[model samples]
Target: MGTPFSFDDGTAICLYVINRAPLVEINDEALALHHLSGMGLDPWNPRRMTALRERIHPFGVTLCNNGALSLLTQETQLGWHVPRFISAELAVAQWAREQMGGTEESRNLAEEVEMYLRAWRPHADLIRHPRQRGISGHEHQFDFLQNDELIDVITPHHNATGGLMRKLVDVLNAGDESAPKVRVIVDDRTDPARAGIEMQIIASLAKAMPLSKLLDRVHSGSA
Candidate 1:
């Protein structure tokens, strides 16, 4: 499917995925109490944070020295999911359909989407700026970038940096010639022994072609 909106000028969306934990091992098998209780709003409560942490101690939490130690629910409140999608227009339309329902909401949602796109049009320069970065929660990083066009997604995976980089590289590889380059930052600075897995993945890529060459092709202007 084609993007719903089009821009005569060059407008790009830069999605920045910050690695709060530049160095840490994530216990993916861990399950938080919120997951069991279905505490949608529990994250906002300070008491809940402490209590939840205590509850998950047994399962072991995902540790990221550079990242914050908090429930995933708490991170969503920071508005990090905004830049996840590539197409803002389509995102709004989809959200409108789901949240508002009915024709009136749909119409209103369309107007709002247009308004958002209109406002974003002027700020395209800022959004597309090389340094202009938008921060999002780590948990939502992959989900948000699954589909987007207006903005380029940035995901820095510290725990499994190589796995994350490989997945992102695969996406760019599958993208059309016109797809904007997606940057996946892998923090290789870690204990040599522990960093072996991630380095191994990078090493494999380097074998076929220089790391710089692979990155250049994905980020090439000709793309």
Candidate 2:
């Protein structure tokens, strides 16, 4: 409805990830430390989750929360089965921590959760495909989340690929030197309609930069 957020760089890419666990099923400690203070971890609520998605969209990334990947894969809710393996491990690690008393073993369990979180990092990398970028969640950290650094919002339950693409086109045509390189990451799996919109957006960009010479100087001389 409003202008889509833009980045200074000219790159536009999308990252798609499938969360292995239901939001409620994730580890309590990680959830406690990271979640919205009073909101609880209710990822299924479209209203709450949609607001969260919008806040993080401005960072040159749009995350489709939950199992939207199933749309691309065409398997209904069956899509999350694969990644759930890691999420299950996360649950187990948390369960293990609870079992440990306040001893050296308990300290080790804490370390284990940290390591598990690190392991989950690859999932983002995997989805981003050929590009290198950071993984962000629906809920952001205290700094970005609280400082109002989040740029825009989109509904996670619905396909937001078109919204992402339109923003890119707007940024390119606007010729804003301050615009960041745009990247729209979608799950390898998404509904055909959503994916079709994403393709259309990409086509529009290709049309914009019809020739190498055209793209070479879009903002080359700006300071």
Candidate 3:
């Protein structure tokens, strides 16, 4: 539980020392590139380690042969050929951040649905998030999947609604003989323009069901 090291610009970078090897954890690409540039090395130049010493000097760290830097200690010798390693770490961290963000957003959307369902369809046995399945192999996940029903919860955002609509179309046309019944629940409190577009898309799809309406249907056991 070492105190994290962070840059002055409000971005936190977690550093862990394992077997005397300092590991840097940076989430944002811009922040990683900024730190890389601060070390006087081009972020994209993975083959050059001309500024390795200068980079480690500012943080009082020593670089190891395996490209792990030593934090707050100069016991380890600096390695000259660690540009590729740093670049790889940054790339992987940035990718992981992006993936984590998507997962978090999906989880938030599912939570919203769960809250509504708890109050309305308290006894309904439904899966919160379910894997996508169809002959199309589109890999489109749903917010809720209960029995033969596939429900997608979308924000009032135009892009979010549009994306859900595309997924619905894919599921409908997936050529699967047993495609589940598709449903969409839109948040009523969305930006007016985006909500209008969402409503229009729902009208066109002929399957737009509001959250309240869906709750009623579920409570009435007609869903």
User: Which prediction has the highest lDDT against the true structure?
Assistant: 3
Off by over 4 Å in 3: 1-106, 190-193, 212-223
TM-score of 2: 0.21
**lDDT string, candidate 3, 1-223, tens digits:** 2124433222355444334346343222233443433222233344333245344454444444434544433224323223333444434334323322342454576687777666555666788556564344535556676556777766565546545655566556768666567777776653555555677787665366666565576668663
Candidate 1 residue lDDT tens string, 1-223: 1223422111222223333453322222212221211111123245544544444443333222322232232244334332222233233223222321232432333343333333434333323212112121112122112123322221122323433343344434443555333432222233434344444554443221122332454455323
TM-score for each model: 0.21, 0.21, 0.48
Name the better of 1 and 2 by lDDT. Answer: 1
Give me the candidate number with maximum TM-score.
3
Ranked candidates (lDDT, high to low): 3, 1, 2
Global Cα lDDT for candidate 2: 0.29
Global fold similarity of model 1 (TM-score): 0.21
User: By summed lDDT, which 10 consecutive residues of candidate 2 come out lowest?
Assistant: 141-150
**TM-score winner, 1 or 3:** 3
C-alpha local distance difference test of each model: 0.30, 0.29, 0.50
**What lDDT tens digits, residue by residue, belong to model 2 across residues 1-223?**
1112211111211223344444212112223212221111233457644644443333222224432211122234333532442333233223222222112332333243333322433232221112211122232211001111111211122223333333344434544345333322222233445544544555554321111222233334211
